[model samples]
Target: MINLFHFVLILTLIVVVISVAKIKDLLSAVILFAVYNLIMSLLWQQMRAPDVAITEAALGAGVTTVLLVAAISKTGRLEK
Candidate 1:
């Protein structure tokens, strides 16, 4: 059961990564990347690494998402 959950999470992460890479819209990619980070944090939590999970959630998912959105708003939302 745990293995299945882990597999699904990893598979979802891979799919999100591929989508982010393929996406031409910068905003969409950023959003997907944020979600990927969230999943990673969740995985860390499940693995009993609370410290890593907290860091990943705060930095990777939270701050990074905010910064990316701010940058995108200042520049452009879509890629040329």
Candidate 2:
């Protein structure tokens, strides 16, 4: 059962990662990247690496997402 959850999480991450890459909307892509980072943090935790998970969550999901949003707001939503 636990392993099933892990599989599903990984599958969802893969789909989200693909969506992030294929998206033309900058804002949407940033959001998806943030979600991907969050999922990665969870995966790291599950793998027994709490330190890495915390770092991933803080930098990838938190600070990076904030920075991306600020940059996007300064520019535009759609990609050229």
Best by TM-score: 2
Question: How high is each candidate's TM-score?
Answer: 0.90, 0.94
Model 1: number of clashes? 0
Tens-digit lDDT track of model 2 for 1-80: 46898999999999999999999999999999999999999999999999999999999999999999999999999999
Candidate 2 residues lying further than 4 Å off, grouped into runs, are none
Error of 1 at 65 (Å): 0.5
Instruction: Give one digit per residue, the lDDT tens place, for model 1 in 17-51.
Output: 99999999999999999999999999999999999
Candidate number of the best lDDT: 2
> Candidate 1: where are CA atoms >4 Å away?
none
For candidate 1, the lDDT comes to 0.95
Lowest summed lDDT over 10 consecutive residues: which window, candidate 1? Answer: 1-10
